[model samples]
Target: MTDLNKLSLAEARDALRDGDVTSVELTEACLKAIDAADVLNAFVHKTPEIALERAKAADERIKAGDAPAMCGLPIGIKDLFCTKGVPSQAASKILDGFKPEYESTVSQQLADAGAVMLGKLNMDEFAMGSSNETSVYGNVVNPWRRGNDDAQLTPGGSSGGSASAVAADLCLAATGTDTGGSIRQPAAFTGITGIKPTYGRCSRWGIVAFASSLDQAGPMTKNVRDAAIMLEAMCGHDPKDSTSAELAVPNFEAMLTGDIKGKKIGIPKEYRMDGMPAEIEKLWADGAEMLRDAGAEIVDISLPHTKYALPAYYVIAPAEASSNLARYDGVRYGRRAQLAQGDGITEMYEKTRAEGFGHEVQRRVMVGTYVLSAGFYDAYYNRARKVRTLIKKDFEDVFAAGVDAILTPATPSAAFGLGEMTEADPVQMYLNDVFTVTVNLAGLPGISVPAGLDGQGLPLGLQLIGRPWEEGDLLNTAYALENAAGFVAKPGKWW
Candidate 1:
């Protein structure tokens, strides 16, 4: 069999069901690819023993004719997910050596579906940065490069490693969490499909918190079909998480009819930012045209509050991050700094935090604390919350007007060289999520599909925003876009 690692999740699932391959064989293929691709720094942890054991069990289940859609599929878990007995650090030093005794609800759900866990993928420290530079495990190099240029590019953040691993065929698919474009941005950078389901679509029970309200787990895969399949396996209501939606998980994979005729796709005017690159602008127009050719009506819509999405996200996310990250004061688990003579409890807390958190994490925590302070609470945090409400309402009004999905550029540009933007003003980096944060703010389902290549020969993606609880319809629309774009280009295997 040719490289089983290169097969998409849906293809592998069909092969496994037809008895054309064994789980061990597929797992070995991924393990071999991962071992040879360490230059990417995607897989932070290697779990060969656990992977082989699970693959063996999956083979048995397949033989017994009881395999699920994700059965025997090898996948990478983001570091933010707490896997039982496996290092689950959120790419932060504070969580060093912190392996949970229990599994995260999403991973547990995948395990129950017989998906084999390959290892933990790298991410931004506590999912803070957009470039993945804040990761304690170091930067995840993008597999794609500018034409004939050897400069290493970032795979985009928080979910950078997951994007890289899937794009490089190190694994069939991986789990990614989006707070502010964490999943969609990385997927766009690496030319994969990533969808952030409606808030509470997947249980957040054991995942590390970045911003509780905005953070959500979703699947990053090679195509829309694979995304649909993996998403079905990853979603379900969990009593353990109060925020989880108490609704039935639909058969997303089966919903991919690719016939989106009469679907009203909105083109929001606010996304057409000033001085936007000609390539991104052209790509957005091409995407709208493609959807129009696919029989969907392209309507121009107004989301007047789009300009405030980034500022609101920065404020709200950090504010929640400040409150959620207060647990790591050397009081419970994970790393603890050694104390000096006469050091009191307060000193320990300060010293431990200063040492454990990275620069970006510290900056966000400080900003969060400042916004939540008594004097500035109303000026910053409260006002941002009100803006978030308007953003949500903007989407509601559009949907109420019969817009089925909205189209926009996934990122302002294609992936940039590593360290190119890190040293610049931090706001430059936050702008990476300009087109993506609005979907998260509205708690709606959004997907990024590889659309076309930029002038540099790097991949660019088109995003589709759908109504809440309509991921099935969203995936079907993404499937239509994927088919129209015909984005089969892969990174030239530099890693």
Candidate 2:
């Protein structure tokens, strides 16, 4: 049999249903691959025992003919998600040793669908960084290197581990959260598929808070079909999360007819940033041509608020983060500092926070606190909120004008070497989300499909942003682009 670990989620599901492979066999294969790929630092916590037990149960379900679409599939849960009794640290020291007593809504739904939990994947601390360097588990090394060079690259973040694991075939698919491009950017960098459904598509109850309004959970998978399948399993209404939508979930996989003829795909003129790399420009043009060849009408559209997305996001996300993250006071759970004899409760709080949180988390928290402060609330946070409304309106107006989806480059460039951007200004690092944050700000469903390679042979992706609550349309469009691009390149195994 071919490598079970290398099988896509859809293929594995079909194979399992046909009795060609047991869930245990598939789970073992992923566990073996994960054990050997430790250099990538992708799976921060291994749960082989739970995986095997769940796999056995899944096998029984398959035999009983009670299987769902995700039955018997081995998938990694992002650490941001709370899996009962599992260490879900959110890759932040502040959350060190924190294990939830209940599973996150999305993970529980996957579990209910008979998906086997392989383990928890790594991520940037509090989902704060773009390059995954801010992860307390060090950095998740991108499986794809630049040509023959030995330099280590990032898998993008804060969903870096999900991207790395899926790209490396460590797991068939993994859960990921997007707040300002976490899912799509990493998927683009690692040559995988990731989708962030419209806000409230997936319940955020058990996921660690980043930017409450901006945080969304989605699937990171090997292809568009797998993304659709896993996304369906991960989405639904949850009364636990007030923001979760009450709408019914669709059979996203069934919607992938890939017949995008006469579909109006918008190409936003504002996405053409000054001094953008020639390769990215060429890749965008090539993607548009491919879609055009596939009979999609590529039309230029304007999202005039594009330029303010990053700044507004930086302000708004940090502000919400400041409010949401106030719960980690050391008095509750996770890490607490060892106070000196003279230290009081106030000192303990200060010391615990100082020791527990990472630099990036602290920086964002400070920024958030500053923006939400009494004197600066209107000047910064409220102003950014108004800008966010304008940004949302920009997409609403475009979509109302008969555009089915908007196509653009997923990221500014391919995966860069680790520590390369960290050495530059932090704003340079934030610029990585320039092409992606607008989707989050506007609360729309967006997907990244690996479209082509860069000059150095690393992968580049094209993003398709669909109308609100229209992930099926977005995934089908992505499927069309996937067929047109025929991007079957996998990173050479180095880990």
Per-candidate count of clashing residue pairs (backbone under 3 Å): 0, 0
- What root-mean-square deviation over C-alphas does model 1 reach? 0.6
In model 1, what lDDT does residue 235 have? 94
Tell me each candidate's TM-score.
Answer: 0.99, 0.99
* Deviation in Å, model 2, residue 26 alpha carbon: 0.4
- lDDT for each residue of candidate 2 in 163-237, tens digit (9 for 90 to 100): 999999999999999999999999999999999999999999999999999999999999999999999999999
> Total clashes, candidate 2?
0
Q: Which runs of model 1 end up more than 4 angstroms from their true locations?
A: none
Across residues 470-491, which tens digit of lDDT does each residue of candidate 1 receive?
9999999999999999999999
